[model samples]
Target: MSSHEKHDVETSSGHDIAPATSTASNGLALKPTALERERAEQLARLPDPDAGKSPEERAEIDRKLMWKVDLWLIPWLSLLYLLSFLDRTNIGNARLAGMENDLHMFGTDYNLSLTIFFISYALFEPLTNTLLKRLTPRIFFTGIIVAWGIIMTLMGLCHNFAGLLAARFFLGIAEAGLFPGVNYYLSCWYKGSELGARSAIFFSAAALAGSFGGLLAAAISKMDKIGGVAGWQWIFIIEGLATVFVGLFCWWMVFDWPETARFLSEDDKIRLQRRIIQDRQGHAATDFDKKYIYEALKDWKTYGYMVIYMGCLCPLYAFSLFLPTIIAAIGYSGTTAQLLTVPPYAVAALATVTVGFIADRTRWRGYCNIAVVLVGIVGFSMLLGSGDPHVQYAGTFLGAFGIYPTISNSLSWASNNIEGSLKRAVAIGMIVGWGNLNGVVSSNIYISTQKPRYLTGHGVVLAYQVLFLLGGTIFMHFALKAENKKRLSGARDNMNDGLTDEQKLVRGDNRPDFIYTT
Candidate 1:
């Protein structure tokens, strides 16, 4: 017998067969690899975990289990982010409600306050996410919320520009974990395909917070000098206290990880564990390891994701922080401008959720982002093109509607494409943290002197949206497509399939079977 034939026949009954030189000819179209054949046979022989149960019985169990998890998880998680974003963006609302007047802030004091928050926020994110890995989610997440809530309350008491800066800086430190932490946590529970929609649900709360903050500020501004406090003070105190209350309640409500969830039955837990493993195609890396962080840092894709994220965030954060101010500059001021901020955010909240659902369903994250960015480009163009305030206001609607969805889409895309817990954690932290540094650039762009038209600010944002952002998105899309093609056409088995479970966790996205989700 030929040596190759002898090698294959000798190992035909086992897994470690010699590699095939080419397909066995019998006119077949595709030749199965030894690993693929072995896997298929093993699956055929193994009993299903739910083998004895009827299809109806299994379906009913799955329905109840999913409903329980969904109900207990999404609402409170969304609420946590809602509060986090409210505390972050309410400063914009407070500015018009006499915060600047009461603190004697002028020129760039307001800009400095906004810029300083993002600096501390960006600096602390990676460390905070790493801490979430070491500490239990329950302890760490609730603690940060309480801490930031306290800082939010203290903002009400800041009597000077320095005091306000101090409050904002600490608030950033406290809030550093939330965005990345939540993204990591969701990946642990949901399939990669599910992340886009789930992230949308989480992010939509931030948009809603902007709307709520606007309406709340308009109402609270009327409470000026109520008791011994200014309306701006009331905004911080009321919102902060509400956040603290919710944070305390989350201690009881939040689920840490599926394996640790007390509410799920043993069968449901096993099923969920199996489903998550299958969803990742055995590539999900759950173990805590420093190597994963190194892998993320070394990967060129990490920086690519970061650049795209920064492009999106520059405009998103700037718009969120300055929408009220921008509206006021467009000839509406006081309560009317605050009220005007409401509809754009409301529209954005809905548009973001819808796009998220579609992105998840279609698995078209890059395309969706490009589409939204295009919409934002149009919005910015209209804002720059128009001499009319009403037209500029309409442009705000398009900008909010577009950019908010892009943030959720891009975020979910990163979470979906990355594998390994630590790698994902590091990637998310770097992308969000570094991306937010653009907020410093954005904060300074809308100079007080250029108010009303702010031609320079609009032009700069337009350039970023059209140039750097569009370029990053297109490059990533093609890069991921090329990588997927290589993997699909290659003959190798999953690189870590022969390794021990512990080694498999370490291998992460390096596995040959793993395909990048674009």
Candidate 2:
């Protein structure tokens, strides 16, 4: 092959090439540009932790490091998330404990209250996530938890609808940072391939919270008329106080970043950073940049993931917030309904973690996302079409199982594909922040008048599930695959030709060397 043809072949193979002398198309000898030389040097300096280690040695090192990280990180984060979720959704339990009657909530008042929380939540998420880099996870997470916990305690003291609405709105603002913030934080520590299972383990806490919330509410409701407060008030006061304690404890427990984590040795930190850099195929810059935020906003893939997230999240919020009411309508008493919510959430927690492990092992997040969504579709279909109470109850288990896992898969997939730390942070915030607006839709659809057979709510959730399958999951899968194919075929080789090394790093996932996870 001619020299030009060889260069083409090398570029097509995704190698960086900056020849000192090369014949141009006009047969002129061209010199390497300064930027090209600089980029080449930067790539040469990129660390490889496995440089001299055997595969077995590397595996052993990884095993020990991961166990240490998981032991210190996942459980504490999961515990905090569990408390966050419990505090957020316990209002559903509160309603069953006669909060509505006590507060004199009229028709649509309760739904409006739920809608207001998500409005604040959706609005604040992106801003909060951006601040996370500045504040650090340790301070950011602890501050938000304490803020929300206080708001939740105030919620118990609400005597009227206005007080309830005020508390809920502030609660939204405070809690908005936790979910997306944790997702971004995890990306800092884990490679793209290892992120799914860890994310699943963290998120499964929401499912566990569901189970715990049900049981806690059931037992806490028995504190009726204690201190002259209603049972519903006790649920909030007790759970909220517990949350405050956990938040305060997080100050001592939460690690800021892998680099700063005191739990890891110097060698472990260096090795971990090298592994992450290698996974990105470049440096993982953490500095804040307006351009990174703009890139995330402009990227079509960010919006695509947001839509997919909404499809899953709508059903998730609807199911969690209304499960007690739905069960009560199916011949169970109020307390019994609260207790019944536990089993579905227990099953869901197990399924979520299991599927997360499978997705990581097989590296098939898209397929797993699609499969679980399909399960949820079958579940909602059963609920909509069947009149038998047994079938409808069984459907709840399927629904919980399917919906909880999809959030983990989708989050990991989005984070896996994005390359820069700040850029991924912005993208996660946008996806989760905007996606949560569906909570408004969920709150309204299950109107009290539609109690026994909430056909409208079931039907809407079912449609969103279908959209998740078709529009979000399938579209993203094919689009990412096609992009990868183009990159592999050298179509993007010249796309960054004129850019400086700094500019190219800022291009993030759009960089030709970066591959999207489908």
State the C-alpha lDDT per candidate: 0.78, 0.82
Clashing pairs in 1: none
Q: Candidates' TM-scores?
A: 0.88, 0.89
What lDDT score goes with residue 142 in model 2? 88
- Residues 1-518, candidate 1, lDDT per residue (tens digit)? 22111111100000122232234458554665433453344335333568789989988877777788778788888899989999998999998888998999999888999999989988998787768766768888889999998888888988899999999999999998998888777766666676778789888998999998899889988888989899999999889999888888878877667757888877676666544444433333334557777888987878998989888888888899989888988888889989999999999999999999998888788898898889899989988888798889999999887688988888777776666656777787888888888888888788888878888788888888887678899999999888878777874455555687556555556666567767
Residue 513 error for model 1, in Å?
Answer: 2.6
131-182: candidate 2 lDDT, tens digit per residue: 8766788889889998888999989999999999999999999999999888
Q: In model 1, which runs have C-alpha deviations exceeding 4 angstroms?
A: 1-49, 54-60, 283-288, 491-507
Per-model clash counts, in order, read 0, 0
Off by over 4 Å in 2: 1-55
In candidate 2, what residue range of length 10 has the lowest lDDT sum? Answer: 4-13
Model 1 weakest 10-residue run by lDDT = 6-15
